[model samples]
Target: MDEIFHVAQTRLYCRGIYNEWNPMITTPPGLYFLAVLFGFCGYERYLNSLILPFCFAGLCRLRRFILISTKGKLKKEIDQFRDVRLSALAICFLPVLLNNSFLYYTDLLSLTAFIWGISFNSSLISSIFLALAVLTRQTNIVWPALNCLAISLNLLKQFLFNQISFKQLFFKTFKFIYQFLLVFAFMCFLVWNNGSIVLGDKTAHKPAIHLPQLFYFVGFTAASSMPLFISYFFQNYKKIFNRFSLISMLFISLFAFLSVNCCTLAHPYLLADNRHFTFYLWQRFFQRHWIAKYLAIPFYTFSAIFMFKMTSEIPNKLKAFYLVFTSLCLIPAFLLEFRYFIIPFALWRLSLDYQSRKAQFFEILINLMVSSFVLYLFLNRPFKWPSDPERWQRFMW
Candidate 1:
């Protein structure tokens, strides 16, 4: 953050700020411009710290919007209470969000723009926020457009089902294409102004077809958000396996086999260095051990199932959109990074439109338990996380 603020303070050229003379940056210049807006104060980090307040404010607003968006799906009484309940459970319990906000990273702002962009009703207004979302983080381009993609997909479905005339479909498509073109124009300008997409050492972000990194990301995300609908998984496991023809198990086996034989795709400097909370414990006992990696694949496989099955009860349009969007979000990544899962996680938490009342109730209960447990753990225990490897050992990779 200080580096970002310093870059903004010293120079205005986006690419130059990240060139060999300065710190490496993989994102667009929106964050630097934002830091400029905050103004140079007592210290660069101090100015950065002020963003946390705005971050939480945006989060509260997002929660309000999410609640309002889903209000119509529930009964009048439940509508009044459900959003607040779900909001508390999902937001308060999420350690990643809390940590990200606490660290005053640019993610909160990007996330704010993303939720606002998707939830806003007006097309022009939504486009503006969506544009802002992409500027905040390059990866956000797809997130803000998810609703549009879903709508577009739904339109195609309508056409396929003979509910909409060919002319109507074409007209809507043409209209949307122009709107998207405007957004794309702005993005191109920003990227050109920033000089490059991967602003840091280009090799750092070179795309790879590694599946293990993606597998880990999927598994971790599923585990983190499992309390949302885990009861359904437990109650219908047998049916799910039978109906799905052991497809879930097959995916599990595939990833497990890959984990042991294939290389682990993880970042050395990602989130407090390479060894984070969960991976730290895994590494302590099973460092470089293929068995541990293989064993962890099943857990990830369950998570993948949970995530894929989240919107099963919702409209197939939404399900298809999510499937495509989630894959697009992960496929290009060279290594595992939890931030990549943020958008899908947000969408997953908001997928309550077509859920049963009982499912909603249990989900709320699970959230409460999880939130309470997280709070309890934080309040009552001493956190003993491992420090970074001494002087960045080569083996750390």
Candidate 2:
């Protein structure tokens, strides 16, 4: 039975290849060539095809030089060595590991690259991974763009605040731009060589210009602006309500939630094809479509409460007012379609706390876990409760 299933799977993949048209290629040559080398071994080929290379790249980029020493037993030493940064890295890797290790999906490759890009502070690497992500699946385009944009904006803000000089900022910005361009060009070249203009033959889809997408952007901007907004508010007001920093953090949290929800609403689709909007609409309206929509409320609620707590200056009444106003403005699209808003809302909230190492670490860990788990459950079938004894035992053991 297993042999028959294997043969059938091979034939299916072969058929997919034979019917391939312009830009309909399965994956980049880097992945394809690897796939071909291991093709004779069936499933092993799929595993080796992307996983090996991804693992290699990931290990190559691991910053072993930052290690700290401790006098303790191996386990104790290792535990202590896993600082917040390492913890953050582990959190980032967990989702990709789960996806690739269990499901054999290539999506994790790009995600890994994205994580590496951020971890190593390598724009070029990030761009390359993002391009691969788009090639693997187009819906991933927003992430690379948003990530780059956020970094750029943060640097710009630092320069404006005299945290960094204009000259230094300019050079850094230029380097990032150059790296992005180079990676993008290489990806395009690879696509062209693979007989595909874009990543896959799949038709590209886009979201309809709707209130939801708009509100998502608004939420994103508000969240991103939280620090500045809070700072501005506090400077103007003599006394802090709850705390100036916390107020700023709230905006960011709201933004992150809204952003994720926005993306969820749109359904991540490639840019080349024209059918993305259809996918977005279908997912948005389908009540039981994905776990992301269902989990959004709790995620956003947590973020909202956290933000409220972070602010020290705003009186409960004012906080209530702020929350109400912000929610009202942001809720329209999110309430109508929740997934499209959650991520951005969370990211926005996160940005406010980025200045604090502890806060930033927590933000990254929570967001990564939440996003990854939701995606994993949604993609898998025969949904079972996590508390099921067998599943829980397997996970724990």
**Which predicted model would earn the best lDDT?**
1
Estimate the overall C-alpha local distance difference test score of candidate 1: 0.58
| lDDT, candidates in the order shown | 0.58, 0.42
Off by over 4 Å in 2: 1-30, 37-41, 44-80, 84-100, 121-134, 137-180, 183-204, 208-301, 304-397
What TM-score does structure 2 among the candidates reach? 0.41
User: Residues 205-318, candidate 2, lDDT per residue (tens digit)?
Assistant: 222323334333343333433443454444544443446545655675565556555554433332222222234434554344555443444334333444444444334553
lDDT of 2: 0.42
In angstroms, give how far residue 281 of model 1 lies from its true place.
5.6
Give one digit per residue, the lDDT tens place, for model 1 in 186-302: 568557746444654666677656566556666756656554546667665776667473776796668567654765555444433432344454456446565666767667666
